[model samples]
Target: MFGIHDLALFVVSGLLLNLMPGPDSLLIMTRSATQGWRAGSAATLGIASGTFVHILGAALGLSAVLAASATAFTVVKLVGAAYILYMAIGLLRSKAQDGVQAPLALAPLPYRKIYAQGFLTNVLNPKVALFFLAFVPQFIDANAPHKALAFIILGCIFNINGTLWCHALALFTGAASRRVKLHPAASLWLKRTTGGLFIWLGVKLALAKQN
Candidate 1:
């Protein structure tokens, strides 16, 4: 049976993992800085909701196939890469039109679209699915009598930890962005940098080896 100690360990691991700064974190930061805390928070919720999807898929053994099949992994990775590249392009275009001096305002995006963006950003990443498959199982001790319950408990803990840390980051960065709103040039450069990072990550992920 899972206990509080296990929960503590899981939370610690999750928090540390969140601090490591991956694609999801970068996405949250970019959206938060470019938009606002509300948008960023929406994206975070989307990501958390996406994690639940992964958990369900993993529980159903769909993620195992994703891990095992190189073709499937590549296909999903390419799709994610494409999406990231598309975002980069959008940023570049926006910068060109806005002359890098425009104030960062929350774009008039529908709430559902914002949420879906977050969900798809996470769900599209094959690496995330693979990570869940590889990471979640280790906490389930073979000796534990209720393996399913243990997996679910640990997964939920991880999701909650991730959401909390990401929300904190969004709040911090969103607030800072407000102070720097006048520096459109700076925002432009930041967008370029963010775009570059996303593109690079997409390329790296595309070239990653399947486990």
Candidate 2:
């Protein structure tokens, strides 16, 4: 069991991290703003599922390989960047129509595909593996009876915090779905903006050095 102080700090830190805007959050927002609450929720769940993989990687020392091997890190990073860029291009090419009913204008794609997109987006980023390797260990107590168990617990806390925030954002976007629906131009701009963000993120990821 972690000390009460450590546990409290972990929760606070986890909450703060989840609040910080990043690719994961952006993906959820884009899906919500452009699609609907259901799509956004699916993306959020997929991202959370990917977090579990990173946590397990960290626990099993697999993340350390990513941290230590520049080649592996670069390979994963480039692949993630490429995938994100592909998504951006798709968004950019989407035709906007007049009288579009906002978020619901486009027929909802299968939730399974959206989920896979979110999951792949998260899992392919080596930076996430590195993040877990660096971030989670800071709160781990060397004197703890079961370090691995503590890691798992703390990682779960991080995932839960993130999921709550993702859902909150999705619901907020859902509430605005009707309003966005009323403005066709606004919907087009939303897609473009989201697409641009993805482009920037892809470039950022491509340039990132292993940390």
Across 1-211, the per-residue lDDT of candidate 2 in tens digits comes to 5511246755764665565455776677667877888888999999999999998877666344443554654465466567667757866665556324434343567889889988999999997886676556545443344545666878898898899989987878766764543244554555566667667766765675444
Error of 1 at 41 (Å): 0.3
Model 1 stretches astray by more than 4 angstroms: 3-7, 62-108, 178-211
Best by TM-score: 2
Worst 10 residues of 1 by lDDT: 95-104
Clashes of each: 1, 0
C-alpha lDDT (0 to 100) for residue 170 of candidate 2 = 80
* lDDT of candidates 1 onward, in order: 0.64, 0.67
Model 1 over residues 1-211: C-alpha lDDT tens digits?
A: 5512335545654565566445676666667777777877888999999998887777457344453554554455466556666756765555533432323454657657878988998988887776665556544443344444555677788898899988987898788874432245654665666666556655655565544
